[model samples]
Target: VGMGDSCAPSNNLPYGTAMEANLIQQLTLRGWAVVVTDYEGLGTPGVHTYTVGPSAGRAVLDAARAATRLPEAGLSADTPVGIMGYSQGGQAGSWAAELQGSYAPELKVKGTATGGVPADLLKVADFNNGSYGAGLVFMAAAGQDAAFPELR
Candidate 1:
């Protein structure tokens, strides 16, 4: 997913949906319908809640709900779903699985597959403090602060 406003998916900018589009394409190739969501503020009017599991998780589940209700999509609440993601998405997908029961009990989630989840923001920041991904540390910091403003 794009990290900044300049590359938000709603901007219709190139490389906006590059990350998981390939995997989504694979599912489509198999004749399955797919839907995606731009987390809590990634493509909207406020600060992108990057790394915020609850927001991302709710967005993911909500997308599924919306997709199922779309008249043209011909989907229903009974439709099965399998969530998967990598990196930032990995965390979101994992959170979705955890919250699916209480947040969206109607979703028939088959399974969840996630990779490279940032289980601990502190560890992630510390590890990337002086590495090539140093900028990610700052980005994560801004995102975390935005999501948990009381802590700021």
Candidate 2:
């Protein structure tokens, strides 16, 4: 399954970013069914959780759980699962990797591929300040605050 990037709320899954469409099509062509998430709040009411690692990771793993339970999806507990994402989504994928062993031990996750992962958010903040990636840093901060209101 693919974890979609950060995006504005949109209840319609088909209207997701082009990247989501491409991933779904490519995976389907290769004989693999796909599932994706709009994260905690995007495409729903309230603020998105954004970069909160545990929240995002849980959403990804939960999607896999929900998918396996769907009989029409032809997925089983034994079916192999792979997680892929980029940028903000990459950080989420990384969290899922760390969380899978304990949070979703039943899942047969074979692998994970993440690109442009913000391995260290503080580092990202320091580097992106006054740079082109500043917007991303701001979003991350806001997301954290929303998830953990004490931070605000």
Candidate 3:
């Protein structure tokens, strides 16, 4: 249910394409409160760095903080939280978990689940050399550029 750069929780797109609606439905079905984030720059004016993990993590965590303050959510300061993501989102989720120890320690991030993590971009580029999946090389380049501007 993790959204990419061009998508946002507030976008009026179809349910399948919007993480907000999907998360809402799932939370309702399970009787849980859902908190959705538009990431750092998706709905705001700025570059939407798709795979910049720290920015993504901060956006997610800050959105949760904002959600907890809403009267409709009825969430308390002591509520437990967990993180999960896939692909680019896996990077963001991992960053969120790592930051939780220092930056939002009260949020109680019990665990995290990530899949298809691009932990080593250089290796990925070598693996996809000269193939159609070589497009991933470009993606890695963009991600690295956003994550480490000095590398750009």
Model-by-model lDDT, in order?
A: 0.83, 0.80, 0.69
- With a 3 Å backbone cut-off (N, CA, C), the pairs that clash in candidate 3 are none
lDDT: the better of candidates 2 and 3:
2
lDDT per residue for candidate 1 within 1-152, as digits (tens), equals 45676555445424545555666768989989887777776777678888889988998899999999998998887999988888888999999999999999999999999999998988988899899988888777777787999996
Locate the minimum summed-lDDT window of 10 residues in model 1. Answer: 8-17
lDDT at residue 95 of model 1 (Cα atoms): 96
**Segments of candidate 3 deviating more than 4 angstroms:** 1-6, 12-16, 19-24, 128-130, 146-152
Order the numbered candidates by TM-score, best leading.
Answer: 1, 2, 3
C-alpha RMSD of candidate 1: 2.0
lDDT of 2 by residue, 23-81 (tens): 67888999996887778766555677777889889988998999998999999999899
Q: Candidates 1 and 3: which is better by lDDT? A: 1
**Native RMSD of candidate 3 (Å):** 3.3
The C-alpha TM-scores of every prediction are 0.90, 0.87, 0.76
For model 1, how many clashes?
A: 0
Clashing pairs in 1: none
Residue 30 lDDT (model 1): 100
Q: What is the C-alpha RMSD of each candidate to the true structure, in Å?
A: 2.0, 3.5, 3.3
